[model samples]
Target chain A: MPVSNSLRSLLPVLILLVLFALVPLLSPSNRFLSLAISAGINVIALYGLSVLFGQTGILSMGHAALVGIGAYTAAIVARDFNVGFWLSIPLAGIMAAIVAALIGVPSLRVSGHHFVIMTFAFGQLLSIILTNGGDYTGAASGLDVQQPVALFGLSMDVLTHYYLMVVSFVALSAIASWAIINSRYGRTLRAIRENEKLAASLGINVGRHKIGAFVVSGIFAGVSGVLLAYFLRHISPSQFASFPSIYLALMVMIGGARLLLGPLAGGILVAFLPELLNLDPVQSRILYGVCLIAVILLLPNGLIAGIVAGWYRFFDRRPVQPNEPAVEREGK
Target chain B: MDVLLQQILNGLSIASVITLIAVGVTLIFGLTGIINFAHGEFLMVGSIVTWLAVSNGVSFWLAIILAMIVVAVMGFALERGLFRFTLERPTNGFIVSLGLIIVLQHIVILFWNANQKSIPRPLNTVWEIGGVRIASVRVMVIFITAAVVAMTFVAITRSRYGRALRASVEDRDTAALMGIPVRRYITGVFVLGSALAGLGGGLLIALFPITPFTGGTMVMKGFAVALIGGLGNLTGAVVAGLILGIVEGLSAGYGFSGWTDAYSFGLMILVLLFRPNGLFGGTSGPKMA
Candidate 1:
């Protein structure tokens, strides 16, 4: 049953990949492909956020800073050391993970609101440092990723090829996220999220696990950053500021952070919704704000979770159990 | 000596504005447990109101008052309509405030356009003491802020409502058990905090140019003051605000203007590392569960 459940979960990811594989064949506009590629990169990072916020119940508002660190690391190395995109991927991931662990150490000491505020400050601090990094960080204007990603002896500068590359990465990230969600570490993290004190009492190293989750998320963000840098061919301090961090958090929150398809659903919806509606950037942001508030009020779990629950209720036809405690229902 | 005096005066003025914003932030956090990310927007809205009033021939002083009143009403409405529902889950409240930040900012942008707005300083005279020169506007801001802080300090420490507020902050469940009407206090605190933020915004625009986006940076500084002072501790906020303002003023004056924000944030990170509850220890604030 467990094997089948795992396989069932993988089915949607497979479908998603198959659908992505069809995008190039349809011959969509370069602009559309670019948006898809951007969304795919964001989806990769969102998966990491899912593990941290969804499974571990730790929300790092500085997630974008980690992404920034990865991008900057890749860009700097590529610029100065003649490091190619392939070589910089692991370097970026390791650098982001190290920074994440460093920030997570002191931040994890304070839980709840303080943790949120601290991460927020850290995000701002990273942007400030990058902006003031002078020529080393390329300053406020930012640095260019001159190294193009080459796969199979072909440069992926074409929109279709790049989209395919991003899609493949998305698939790989989704599968890895799924594996993590089903792993023993995932369960332990969920236990910590459910009740830190109880988990601590049950012999869990809650602090270490929280830092581990952050480091893992940082690695994911780092790879996503690499993809983003190469895709855009430019990286800026402003891109990874506190506002962008908030934007990433908004994506995860809207998509249902805990579910397998949440990141994909959220990433696509947020990336496409404004474009599809033809709304300007300001109007779309306002809409996102309203949506976030409404989601929190009406569907606290998230859009995907709410939809899944609705689907279950429609099919199950279970009698109303009024006297059953809310906690017991949650336990089930 | 002259440079030191000038920096001290500048720091005092900066601290005054931060104190107003930080106090409101701490008060709201103390009572409602929401970080109120939109508190900066509340400040922005206040500055907008002040700008509108001043443009329409209202006195700058009256404009500040109008801004505060308008923002206070906004606070009441948001608390009653939106934030009241999220009391059971503070994290949701925080997220809701994040949404509110975006919504409020863009709404301001949609209506007013995202251009920097500035108000003529109400007092343009400079008072020179020895070799040091201080703008009368800065002095006025410092005096006004000091008065407001004193009034708030006295009210919270000595008044009946203040006692109830402190009690609610200490423990919501017990405060309600004691018939303190914690709900009403929460509303009152929210309104007061919003009003203070509005005043801070009004003062902010008087000092510098402001855009709809100014709130982001201001709010970070405000939170730094609030957290460094101790999240819910009023006196701590004032002290932290002073320290932050001085640090920022010194950094800016010493030709490290670009890194002034870095200094404040770095100080905050260090304080958080050493004293997670804030420098003064946030005992007067709600106990973290």
Candidate 2:
């Protein structure tokens, strides 16, 4: 934990952020920049997911509902209370966290299979409720956010400005996620994930810690949701349905949920892979399904984890334990 | 009173179909420890096949049989090719099933457009009893489901294979050590479960219009029934399914149609909170790890 060691550990993240910062300077087309901005927002949420799935070993199949809650909170607050974008960001996150805690409390009591099913049901329930919300929820056709995000006398209506804002948030999220993963609480979650009974025997409050992980992830999803609302200027219940949750889960799984760079890599790859391949939405989804199966079977940790292990094997000539902490593996 | 009776009858028919799907889900989970998210997709495929067969001039009953066979074969293939590899980790099996949901749904969409498809009702007759009218097709579905459930119950309780399946469900390792072919039993249960879902699908299209996306909603309801009945408990599924169908029927009939789905989800959450092991608490499922 020396200053030099801390800086060394942050080197990769710093390099990655610099590259992200240069995207707009590269003079990419607006369409490409928009896609990058969307991906950046997803990366923010994925970092939260990594802490839950990667560190705590709990996969929430209803994460998109949490995101939807955030998005809807922002829209409602802006419409009803005349809140601005800046205030709505924190408001949305808090709203999502509160809902996450409510669902997580009872859901955490069940076993893994039941938990997954419960979350899936909850996602469906949220969408259905939204669709039946009548005037309050705009009833299914969805709500439009009329207010544009303004910062320090500068309008973020331009694509470049919005992209930078999203990128900065993504960077902040990555740093927060990195800090969490390296903290004592992260290690406790990891210990619980490895062996809940053993961790409980050692005086760890397993249930509280698990719920805490869910809330943390929920906050990330909420912030991502606000960014999405402002970026698209519209939000719908369908966008945050069970399939989107599955989509988010798929990206995290494919990118190596345990790795620090996994979310950024996963977000960009999933967003652009179909475009790059010139495939239709259905075709891309089929490909994703195949990729997920292959990853789970052959590379249980994910794409980046597999590559990192291979790199270590090839260069360092040392056998990396499959369960070795990802940060330590990278630091070495 | 007549409307109440009619709703109750309608509820029974709905419950029958739900029971078929829920029992299949429970059976597979009991033996394999894998919650097949694609089980509803199997049902969808079955309904599609039934529609194809009936449109191509096959008898409705014969078409149902054909669909069951086709889906059973698919179940066997998946068990051998995909699920067999994930036995060591049930969570992996679950993920693979999620993958299967995407693959199967899109494949269906590619072959047949995403529009809703319906089959002609073979029995258009309506029987009126005590001022309550019931469609003959509904009665047929109820009778067929009841017969299937009875047969399944007898098989599990009286037949040699039933005893073996029960033993395996109770303790897979011990069952395997006792000269039981646990692997083959797993395949058998999976295939049987898939076939049951196919039968339910065939019956479902007779009652309602279906699309490629119907699996998502169907699976949710099926899980609700299965879990509420106590996962891995067949009797629990039937009773739970009956209760769910009746409640849904009354709710929709009484002008709460917009929130019919929400009721099921809310009921499921409440059950999970109160009885995490399910209402019947007769799970042969694995211990929480």
Candidate 3:
């Protein structure tokens, strides 16, 4: 008999774990290690976006604001209340989740277009408030974050912080995303995405489910924000504008919205490419725009989904017969 | 009293510009069923081209017309090349427009060098009435907008092409079956919308300076107008634009100036809350998500 199906499916997870374990063993230079760490941070947020767009089909373009909220929360809490990273971390996620639910409640109740506009407004409103928030938010100049979050009474360096983030939050976030996508709630969400009316007819509260997805996505973004804040050591309103939201949306699309590993690939592409290629900011942005158009027109399901589907189509075709039974013909 | 009157005038002038831009968006949405984010860039194109023409010594009237023609042609080419492919899919159209936003802005910046450009106003004389001062340029803007709105009203109500556009917007397949060239009319709407946006941009030169990056803010305002008036509802768009202007004016005038953008956004949120179909109820339009 074949091995257990659960174990078989976990093979991919095992492989990824092994790869991550081997990451540090490669003895990468100071720079490569730093790049890898930032890529990891981006991946967490990318996965959050995947939950919203990929699983829920919400197409929100404001995850960046949630990320910013998370970052700001962490920075402010640390600066004012003298909280450690550990406490600030959970607080950030909670704060972002509340804001997401607040905005998502009414907007998500409306039609999809309104939802898009509302999410955009959420980002814009956040930036505006931050700008006028005066000394508390440091206004337009933004607040510089000090005090590295210490663990076990010891302050960590950049290199050690990278490992801790990767080994702890990054791994946990991935596992949590995997669990959410495979759970009963996840099944209902997927159903709603496929056909909202049908799902509602079947007794699924579509609105509630959509809100749940938004909150979960917001939590992911918040955690990612915390990571981003730690990485940058600063927090500001300009950092959270709709452009970053669009960038997150772009990253999700580039990776293929529906694939588990898609955002992982996408985050890496977005984070590392500009730095490695030394591309002009304007040129890189133009490249993103062109790629988005090309991807939608030529590969609407995203790059990975397109490739996998194409591969399956190539080798899985069945010959048609004029005399085939109706059932068989239908399957063909 | 003078301040209040002047603010009201400012609000009306702004409302007219917003209505001009919002109309273009609503027209495209009505016919093509896509929210064209690049509509603002059309305004940008119009302004820049007009500025270039004027600075190079072209007559102001000739420059504005040339600006309209160039932007309209660019709109037609974009529709045929890029937008036409995404017509049946609103979601794709949305994403494609975002892409076009990036591409168009950069292309403008690359050629124009990302500098703010302003034209010397030919009509700078200020008119005073009851302690309120109104720039002659403001008067010109209001007059031109009135004439254009009237012309547009006539075109949509009386002309054959306008009838075809309205018919297709009401029901596409039926219009096609009824011998209307639905495809051509859709493209025509795209061109017309672009031309209107271009002309609005040219008109804005008398009021304010512009840069290649200004399109982002304009598009946001256009979206606010479109949402407030119901998406795809032209009449609603016009009313919403004026309402936005008045709200912004009152808020900015009354010392809530720092929160001007906030007030506009808050109004949009309120509209989305109370009149999800827009202030003047219209079709919900297609939901993409």
Candidate 3 ranges with C-alpha deviation above 4 Å: A1-35, A314-332, B286-289
Overall lDDT per candidate, in order of appearance: 0.86, 0.85, 0.77
Quality class of the docking in candidate 2, CAPRI style: acceptable
Looking at model 3, the pairs that clash are none
* DockQ score for model 1: 0.56
Q: Write the per-residue lDDT of candidate 2 for residues A36-97, one digit (tens) a residue.
A: 89898888899988998899888788899999999999999999999989999999999999
Q: Which numbered prediction scores highest in DockQ against the true structure? A: 1
- On residues B1-289, what C-alpha lDDT tens digit does candidate 1 reach at each position? 7787888889889889988999998888865676688999999999999999999999999999999999999999999999988776666777789889999999999999999999889999998779899899988898889899889989998999899888887777788899999889889999999999999989988888899998888787887788788877889999999988987887778788889878668877777777877788685245533
TM match of model 1 to true structure: 0.95
Clashing residue pairs, backbone N/CA/C < 3 A, model 2? none
Per-residue lDDT value at A206 in model 3: 86
Tell me what TM-score chain B of candidate 2 gets against the true chain B: 0.96
User: What residue runs in model 1 are displaced by over 4 Å at the alpha carbon?
Assistant: A317-332, B287-289
DockQ score of each predicted structure, in the order shown? 0.56, 0.44, 0.44
Model 1 lDDT, residue A240, Cα? 99
